[model samples]
Target: MNIPGELYFTKEHEWVRIEGDTGIVGITDYAQHSLGDVTFVELPKIGADVKQFQSLATIESVKAASDIFSPVSGKVAEANKKIEDDPALVNRSCYSEGWIAKIKMCEPSEKNNLMDAAAYKKFVERLEH
Candidate 1:
């Protein structure tokens, strides 16, 4: 619901914030709402390599567990350790502190394939109908 203007989105419901050759990834607000109250998360370790549209992490909520997809191909540079300690942060702050991983983007051009906020906004609108 709160799709920030600066981020890109994937059909899998992941959001990406790009900065230079790095990207911060996380599930969108719509994803957290659909999942209900989050209980746990399995984040990929640093140095892990991830491919576009592939599984990068897993999130468990009261409703269900889901695999979080990578919006771009990259190597994991860092993960939000705080979320492992308190998964609720995802429900509370999905855009900022709740970001799951920071990747050293392997192909910066891949971002062009991802949906911009406006496009993603339209995509979610289509889903609601």
Candidate 2:
């Protein structure tokens, strides 16, 4: 899987790329690979309040439907409309173009609860077994 070192990961397979106080969130590469060809994405509304580890969006794929959880609590600042139009972008480039939402962080300290890339890689390995 493509687990970028700079990002933080959740046990639920979401990732957060922190930029200042904003967190760019998305399903991990491992998540997209397991889900198969993505067909639809239901994103949170702008200004919606979300909680850490709570359901932020729902993604439907040929294999299954899965909830994308927030790795940090915040208000939804932006949702990627590109994924709404071409859901397959998730399967193509989950880390970049497939990012689901941008959150204006309510508590940056919540980041301490997340795993680093190395830990997440080990987590994914355990899942495979």
lDDT of 1 at 23: 94
Can you give the lDDT of residue 42 in candidate 1? 99
| RMSD in Å for all candidates | 0.6, 0.7
Instruction: Write the residue-wise lDDT of candidate 2 on 1-129 in tens digits.
Output: 789999999999999999999999998999998899999999999999999999999999987888999999999999999999999998899999999999999898998999999999999999999
Q: What is the Å distance of residue 12 in model 1 from its true position?
A: 0.8
Model 2 is weakest, by summed lDDT over 10 consecutive residues, at 61-70
The lDDT values for all models are: 0.94, 0.95
TM-score of each: 0.98, 0.98
Tens-place lDDT per residue, model 1, 1-129, is: 799999999998999999999999999999998899999999998999999999999999987889999999999999999999999999999999889999999898898989999999999999999
For model 1, what is the error of residue 92's alpha carbon versus the real structure, in angstroms, after optimal superposition?
Answer: 0.5
Candidate 1 lDDT score relative to the true structure:
0.94
Instruction: Judge candidate 2 against the unseen true structure and give its global Cα lDDT, from 0 to 1.
Output: 0.95
Report the C-alpha displacement of residue 74, candidate 2, in angstroms: 0.6
